[model samples]
Target: MNRISMVAVLIAGVMPFTVGCATKKYTREQAAPIINKTNELDDLTAKNSRDIKDTDRRAQSGIADAQAKATTADQHAVQAGQQADAANKNATQVNGQVASLAGTVENLDNYKPVAESSVHFGFDKADLTKKAKDALDQLGGQFSSTKHFIIEVEGSTDSTGDADYNYQLSKRRADAVIQYLADKYQIPAHKIYLIGLGKDKPVEKNATSEGRAKNRRVDVRLMTNTGDQQQNASANTPQGGK
Candidate 1:
């Protein structure tokens, strides 16, 4: 055989193996970018999941803070409402007291003494006898028919006890008479003035039994603004309570 033919045979034998190596290198080059891209995408997905978890935690914390503020506001509202109610009640009471004071002031100069009566009592007692009730019944009837009339009741006691004790006993006697007149005649309590003289203003001497009985008496004086006898009795006695 010639030398050229022998060289050609040697080249043919190695060509298939060289082509196979080149094909494998080309395929590996093409797949390298796809593998790197897949790794980058996996890392980005893990970071996104961590960020989403952090955002959820912050949102829950904000919700809890808002709920605490809402609870505080509700408690403050209840306290304010209760305080407002208390203030309103105080204002109403003050207004009523002012009105009553005004009414008393307006009627100061329009009344005068017109008539009087008396009821006697036993020693150291507040209960009324039959004679006392009969006297009060007579006065009550006359006063009921009159217009704008007020009664002043003065009570006294015999000088047999301490002054303080006598004073309180005298007051009890006056109150007993006042209550009877009010209940029996339906007279308003505002029109009556009550006073306790104790042993101070005695109409009789204190040494004798008859004089002490006269001292232990309740004197009731009726006064009126209506004036038929105003010119006849102009020096009307002043009514006072102590």
Candidate 2:
């Protein structure tokens, strides 16, 4: 050994030791930063997962609440609809009853006479016969018992005369009956309404003498009172005058 060879050998051995120490230091520093970053990321991920689970729970609760409210609302609507239908049905029934009452009132107000007796007239004359006068006198007695009385003296004639002449003659016959009742029984003239149907409503055939005599007659109709008719109708009803 020379001096230069000894120096080179020692330097080479020392350089290897220094290189190994530097490599170990660098590996430790890099591994520490990586581990810290990984831990931070894991914490953030756990927090986000918990938040998502809480949001899902809140959403489920909201859905349940909404469903309950909807069910209650549906039930209320059904009840309201049923009540309204019942009210409408009741109104319809009331309207029908009112209409029926109105119709009955109208019918009573417009009541006309129904024929109860008849009087025969002469062949061509409108004069009152003795038999006719007797019949009229009997009818006049019934007027005092009635609430309202109207003597509808409707005269009819035989088919032998002309239509115009017969109508006039029938009118004269009704007038004569009214006058006779007024003069004999002191009945008011306004109580009687004279009408002449002529041969329009002949009760018998016009070809025979007996039929002609039958046709030439006056109908004395006695009308029932509105109260009486109403009472009759009420008697026939199910509610019995309610």
Candidate 3:
């Protein structure tokens, strides 16, 4: 009775423990595939997030490249517009010069020379020398009795600088002469015809210093359409001072 009773008690206790272990093992096996599936899903989500970030970076880079290209195109357009404007301005200047030449040719015979003078200047200088001023004074004296007269002032320059710079220099020389005449004789603006020839019409070759000095000069010719005015001006024509 004692052995049988002990054996039955031990069997009952062992049966419950074995059943509990089997249930625990079956639960673990069933949850294992779900855990692996969850792990796989987590890995896919992380890869998708990385791919989305990389795509966004590439899209931002592409947009930046497009913006850079657009900025470069805008700069090129601005440069092209500036160049076109410069070309148009040059064309307009040329047309005005042609019209001026035509007018001069048409009115050539309407005037006759009454008095003439020439004044020289220093290198790159527009200020009048004492001798040059004295020479101009002689020409200015003739304007008192002259009527309906025009003073032709042709300024020149030596070939020593840029063509555009020389043109401006010659114009400054001409302005100096005009100022003296206008101030001293009260000459009207309409009675003066001015031209800046620059180095295009040098009186002497520019190869020598003396020749260049001679080229830096302004030529003045007092002219009138009226015969009586011309005769009157001839009496006061400048002599050796010119």
For model 3, how does the per-residue alpha-carbon lDDT over 50-121 read when each residue is reduced to its tens digit? 999999999999999999999999999999999999999988987886675566457768778999999999
Mind giving the per-residue lDDT tens digits that candidate 2 earns over 82-159?
Answer: 999999998898788677556645555555664357888878988888899888878877766765555677899999
lDDT (C-alpha) at residue 117 in model 3: 96
Instruction: Candidate 2: list runs displaced more than 4 Å.
Output: 1-109, 112-115, 229-242
Q: Which regions of candidate 3 deviate over 4 angstroms?
A: 1-108, 228-242
Top-scoring candidate (TM-score):
1
TM-scores for every predicted model: 0.53, 0.48, 0.51
Return the number of clashes found in candidate 1.
Answer: 0
RMSD of each: 11.7, 19.6, 11.5
177: Cα error in model 3, Å: 0.3
Rank the candidate models, highest TM-score first.
Answer: 1, 3, 2
Give Cα distance to truth, residue 55, candidate 3, Å: 77
- What TM-score would candidate 3 get against the native? 0.51
